[model samples]
Target: MSSVDKQLDELKTDVEQQIPNDITVTDVKYEGPELVLYTPDPKRFAGDGELVRKLASKFRKRITIRPDPTALTDTTTAEEKILSVIPEEARVTDLDFHHDTGEVVIEAGKPGMVIGRHGATLREITKEVGWTPEVVRTPPIESSTVSNVRNFLKQERDDRRDILERVGRQIHREQLGREEWVRISTLGCCREVGRASFVLSTADTRILIDCGDKPGAEGEVPYLQVPEALGSGANSIDAVVLTHAHLDHSALIPLLFKYGYDGPIYCTEPTRDLMGLLTLDYLDVAAKEGRAPPYESEMVREAIKHTIPIEYGDVTDIAPDIKLTFHNAGHILGSAVSHFHIGDGMYNVAFSGDIHYKDTRLFNGAVNDFPRVETLVMESTYGGRNDYQTDQADSEANLVEIINETYEKGGKIVIPAFAVGRSQEIMLVLEEAMRSGKIPSMPVHLDGMIWEATAIHTTYPEYLRDDLRDRIFHEDKNPFLADEFNHIDAGEEERQDVADGDQCIILSTSGMVTGGPIMSWLRHIGPDPDSRLVFVGYQAQGTLGRRIQTGWDEIPVPNPNDAGRTSTLSLNMDVSTVDGFSGHADREGLMNFVGTMNPRPEKVLCVHGDERSVQDLSSALYHEYNMRTFAPKNLETFRFK
Candidate 1:
């Protein structure tokens, strides 16, 4: 070993000694001039920034500390590190700390590969590591370009803020009314149902309903922190009402906390469980990208403590004379349709938080009846009639056909799906089909946070569909725990097992293929022509999954290295998709829900749809319900009642 290697080993031994027995050294290695050490427990050296400084002092060289490579372990290989800095997830390849210059370097691929869209990665990571990471392009690596790149990124950040300002101004102008109002802004997610952020303001309280990611055809639309919505001067908001735990609706909650919104986060029991799964994963991804997550791990724990869990149908007062109630949205296990009895009937508004029109295998459809409210805030995810009639049976058959075809050809089938909603449904469908011998029984691998989230789902059987709850309670036949399924947690050996598996079915997360174990699995399987990569969820633009889904013959994936960061693995898997498995109701479903409303909402605000989707849905709902409808642009406020 060279002097660097010797130092790394010595440092590893020192850290190993310093770390309590509970924390293990999963790996240690030299990356460029810096000695990087990864420990199983991130807090093993907490408040030990001094220890790190001392360690680097010994090297007379720069050094960095990070969570152990194994700390990011999930169902896939140890290579992919879901970043722990930003709200979104990305596959991080390599991390470098330059001793000579005190610069940290990060290399990622695709859109997420960059620290974050619009400098979010750099800003977030810098806050976390107490140092800024300079991101480098994949391959043809050169340090000389750092200054030029930094200038360019800074320019991009400024441009992004300008755009948000323009959008915010337009939204505010369009939405302002003589009376206080509420506006729902849609963020479209390509692979899954889009999310919406609701801005509700009275004379006193200003609340952002659900601030989450809206999937777009590409990577998410740039996340511009809406400064106006954050409020200026004394007109700050009171609290945020989280519609549910879905990422699109709840992922950005930390940013609020990060920016000093000292308010309560309100949601339901299952939503809380799901939020735990999402927020933890979100932080994990941010950390890996060399950016600090907006909220620290401790903040997440603290935020959870402030989560005021409300029961469905119970009217709880958030402020003087302002009561909030949650009705089962039936879209996901713990999702709700929110009713805000705001200010003495001046504004009786309801937000349909991604409601489902029809019952699913696991949950009831959205509650059809509610007190007749003046303003109805709804999701237009399937706004247009284009997706009115997706044949679920056909989609299920397609899943089987794709799986059988891949298996018959002696290849593995990898399904990239959402951990909470999509994964559970897919598992049930696959399990039932296998039980009926409709498809061959294979080694089914669950390689994402799905199993853990599913375990949490079990804690709230009352919220699930009656049959599923009955199966869990009486028959003890938990659909999520079929005997054929194997849970893959992060570890060297299990990842090797997955990579080496000859024929199998594997499911993983960051459903849009933004990050998670799926990337590593894709790296290993994508090169094989026989391998089938099926996407059961939506694919946003700029994501590797979308690139592949759009028929890109090859794509870059993360290959983790012990040296510091990671490198790209070229992916060339046979890709397929099944849109029917989507959790959101389709176009007809949206219209049906609107058509069924009792005293009929006078005004309909359609959000959570793309431009095309929103426009189409708005027109259709008008024709069907004869309700005045508007698809408000982002941040646009609207007058109600």
Candidate 2:
């Protein structure tokens, strides 16, 4: 190696020595104002604030360490600057800056107090500074009080579980004496996707179908942990099978480890990759907000150690009496619908794990089989009357037209896209449109995790469209490599260019405008009547995207500076949505899968979709199949035999 290279290596070694043994540096790069270090260990910087300050002092320049993609641990002045402007009543609890990606996060408890009435204080903070402020509150607890509360809750939960177990055993005894029946229960079904947590158990083996989280506003989603299910199934579980990599289907897998469950987590290869990406990402988000993640980084690592990557159609015996197989769910890349064969008799069950009946440029349609399946656990993400499809071609055409029109009027277009699925879809659409001359070729900028994640996607090509994957594998014509696209990883300088560009389309993440590079773009472009901000995914309730979608003319966003000020940026830009890009199956597609299944299922439970979607889908299923269908509320449990 050259002298410079050698010196860099030496620097790395020295830096490694300074960091805790558990924290492994993934990358070391220089941004404008700081040297940024990334580590996969979420607790790398926690409780080591003094060590961080010492390191920063040695550098004399700012230093940032990100344990996860969305989190930062640093002694940057941005937070202090922002804090100065915050009202006295609004106390700052935690502040972090992700220098590698220019993510400035300020988290405070009692955010409402700091935000003031009508978000006046918040507006002042954002307008003055660029830091994205996220405020959360934790109910105060004395150590003694907390212990008492914990014990009480634990005892109560244990009592309930004991009662349920006794009843379950009685039922099992009766069923065994006569005939026999399998019992199933689903946990962690977020209502937005018609996804659920399913538990299936026989005399010999018990299995968790999917584990996940509910959707809500940032800092508002209290942990939805079902200790009874996890603890009960821990020692005796055959395996935990993941359907897809989406958070609602996979987020809580680490929690299993936290609760002393060490069974293998079985998922598709792509699902495995996505889980690694997501679990780390979630840790960063949680850390930045000064909230301890529901599961620690160590637990995530432990979970990873127990993961077994299974390809679709590869049947494996997770237990003496249980067998597992995965089929293409045709949602996002690597999504799967799981099938389980249990017991010696005629007991079998198939779970449609966020199924996508519609074929896409990415994945094939879900399989229609299991002729003798008894019970079906399915999603209703699009299970409502309002859920339908706009042709993909038409949606792309409309998207191109909007961009062309906005650019013709000398406006820039800002699209807040999800980093993984929606970002890839938008990129594909843009590439096609630009190639077809539907719109002028302007610099298309991609920010946030999309660019990095796209590279990861290429590593697992089988999860994508077969034809596209083959072409890229053999001939090397990667569609993700559009000529007009540019990656923006530099600090504020490259951002300024995008902001000042005459006609450009900038795609950034925190699709809901909740955080990430999108905030910077919004701060710059949101006030421009000539600019357009297009939201291409679902905006969960209480997100800035929802506010914009709901026609709020002005909204309060995070101030880039650490000062506790806010900005009331004018929403002069034309706000729009292209819902077709969602990775979810629409209502018609969902219904089609349910309607066409072979031999039909005896019972169906629909969750994960919005209330309207779930109910409509459930109603439709009831009308058509005359089967038991339900749309359960959060934390609500149902037993099936």
Q: What lDDT would each prediction earn against the true structure?
A: 0.65, 0.66
Model 2, C-alpha of 523: deviation from truth (Å): 1.3
Instruction: Write down the RMSD of all candidates, one decimal each.
Output: 19.8, 20.6
TM-score per candidate, in order? 0.68, 0.69
Q: What is the lDDT of candidate 2?
A: 0.66
lDDT of 1 by residue, 260-299 (tens): 7655667886686577668778778656545455567655
Q: What C-alpha root-mean-square deviation, in Å, does candidate 2 show against the real structure?
A: 20.6
What stretches of model 1 exceed 4 Å from their correct place? 1-195, 214-228, 233-235, 490-492, 562-570
**Against the correct fold, how does model 1 do in TM-score?**
0.68
Q: Ten consecutive residues with minimal summed lDDT in candidate 2?
A: 138-147
Q: Best-fitting candidate, measured by lDDT?
A: 2
- Residue 137 in candidate 1, Cα distance off native in Å: 49
Q: Candidate 2, after superposition: displacement of residue 440 in Å?
A: 1.4
In candidate 2, position 546 carries an lDDT of: 81
